[model samples]
Target: MTMGSGGSSIVVPRNFRLLEELERGEKGIGDGTVSYGIDDGDDIYMRSWTGTIIGPHNSVHENRIYQLKLFCDKDYPDKPPSVRFHSRINITCVNHETGVVEPKKFGILAKWQRGYTMEDILVQLKKEMAAPPNRKLVQPPEGTFF
Candidate 1:
């Protein structure tokens, strides 16, 4: 088990899969939908990560850049990481006050699989932004954070 930033503890097995995540993050995943890296590059056990998602083409979110932070605890992979947006966004799946994604509202978080990487989550979110209900809604100013 390992401790998180705020004194939270999580279980970390021998096959934590963190190294796998790091390599995947560094090498770049396909689709060009998103990109992520350790928040503090020097730390391989990288608990904090920052991600960017390119707004979908020809949409209200087009040409916009969304920034997010993902916190992976020792229980990550086994349990979904805590995801928050440093950029303000009004979507059903996100908590307005905390910027935390709602696992129940976000399918990937509720039904997480080990094979799913942070890229999958970002791509899925970009898809969600274009979803019918979200697509029509006006967004807050860019760079506005929660």
Candidate 2:
């Protein structure tokens, strides 16, 4: 693993960074509300991932489980992954018809940094579900997919 601290600039190679993320995903994150894993075990490049987010409480999305697809291309880490919801949702940041998360509408992906991980995206999305504008928005029927 590459380490950078203070004024130093060190970049972790793609594969090493991806392995670290994979391990963390398997371990489960805080509160167990969001999780992600490799989409295909045979994919040596680890390009695709599946993410799950349980809707936050006290919101229109509450108790709903949302599924998403994330694609980490060759420039991953340096560039944000493409994210799209497989499960239909009605949120300000997500496109209504396509289920894609529009970077222009989502600050996290639009202002992505090299250190951000798939977990960050999932966690942030969960938070978005609780945001004022999205919290009360009417959502599609449960278990419906794009």
Candidate 3:
């Protein structure tokens, strides 16, 4: 189903949620560490979205904006989407090769719930950045791409 058309029953609800997410982002959330939206701006289903997570203050990731991709497939809202990083960094949950966050290692994704929005995932990742093991790890040089 094409996203912009909203003609498919399969994608209708997903598109609605995505639209809500975009609007929520435009209104702005209080946290300075995260933001997200439709990747290309024209897709209504927004199956592919781009998200940014700022490094938590005082943590190794501080001052850095990590780029991420979130893919919500047909089963979305019932199942969590897949996430990958475009920016390089040291994080325990991330796969070094694929850049995909391992659900087994990443609690938020592992424990993802249908009601959770992509925003929730981004914030959870921010928390992970401040998490003990990750917080103290040496950071890669900024602007590094994976």
Candidate 4:
């Protein structure tokens, strides 16, 4: 495995063996939806990832493919990754303060725990998008395409 900069050793827990698979470029266990990639820095950690969720199988998002992005920190595995929708999502409960998509307005990202993983977060986000608590909300303003 690639070592972290500054000579600081990265600790891996035995329970989360998937981390090793990720480090070795193996696909996630059970669900291939979760994957990893290196960012511009070439860090050995799963700094970025992408996945698609099939709506909710029967909900509004059913049959719809939803894209997602996961940003991992240097101290990953011990810290939850920040996940966001790669595609446009219409929701009115977003946090104006952080400019993040907060459908529940409960600030789930802000309350992330170290035990969380990219797969875990993506699963939760898919569930929320499929059956949003506030379905009547309008989509966020679209950005101009260059």
Candidate 5:
């Protein structure tokens, strides 16, 4: 099946299931909202999703809104989704390779499992922002925006 506007095609089983979960989550299955996009004709299965993260309580990010992006490949579900902070979040734990902000202090992104949904990742990111282990840590260099 294909979704969105990139011509990307998703094989029926795993990728389709993940897409369904994303739709459900957008419909209020979880805390935040998620939006998805796919190419028009390609079968490569590259999907992109956007979501919001409510800053954690009692922290610098608390009450502030953050944006998140999720990139899923054709092999999704079998492999974890690539997640990153879309809004300006200054942090050091972000993976230099994938450009996704890593809340290593909480070990959530690092411990991602296949059964995890996009909602799970968003929730974990919110938890990490709410109570980061190193609140005093400074954001990485200015050009690190992904």
Candidate 6:
């Protein structure tokens, strides 16, 4: 919910927000570097999703495609979704064994606000791939999955 022009509360329903995200995902995000969609078209709640990120250039992950799963529970938008990489990766913010993006280690999840979207998360992960330390780190062979 947000305060309107007259200090009135404006609330965007969860399904409405997810639907908007779905539409944007279908239309394709900028540069096609990141994208996501509903995991199951039959899911009325729109809870599970699949995200893909093309690793940033000039990094070890360059040209590599990474897949991830996102689970948005009942409180999404108000609460961040659970993100886990399906493609194996070695990043400071991701758990080595389980591939989960650790909230305490990732600023986006740690300081989540209602305004953040799934696209934001995927894009940020791509940015993380280009950032220092991670850029030069050796990665598992391509096509490997968790």
Candidate 5: clashing pairs of residues: 5-39, 6-38, 6-39, 6-40, 7-39, 7-40, 7-41, 7-42, 8-39, 56-130
What's the best-to-worst order under TM-score?
6, 2, 3, 1, 5, 4
Candidate 6 segments whose C-alpha is farther than 4 A from its true place = 1-5
Looking at model 2, residue 14 earns an lDDT score of 98
- Candidate 2 deviant stretches above 4 angstroms: 1-7
Better of 3 and 4 by lDDT: 3
Please give the range of 10 consecutive residues that has the lowest summed lDDT in model 1.
11-20
Ranking by lDDT: 6, 2, 3, 1, 5, 4
Residue-level lDDT of model 4, residues 39-143, one tens digit each, is: 433544546665555555544554555565666666565655555566555544334334355634534455666555555565666556545564434544443
Backbone clashes counted, model 4: 1
Pairs in clash, predicted candidate 4 = 90-139
Sliding window of 10 residues with minimal summed lDDT for model 5: 32-41
Q: Write the residue-wise lDDT of candidate 3 on 1-146 in tens digits.
A: 23354554344476787777889977776656698878777665678988899899878998898999999988887788999988987899998877798889988778877678889999999999999999989877899888
Candidates in order have lDDT scores of: 0.82, 0.94, 0.84, 0.51, 0.60, 0.95
Off by over 4 Å in 1: 1-16
Overall local distance difference test of candidate 3: 0.84
Can you give the TM-score per candidate against the true fold?
0.82, 0.95, 0.87, 0.57, 0.65, 0.96
Highest TM-score, which number? 6
Better of 1 and 3 by lDDT: 3
Q: What's model 5's TM-score?
A: 0.65
Q: What tens-digit string does per-residue lDDT give for candidate 1 at 82-117?
A: 899888888889888888889999999999986677
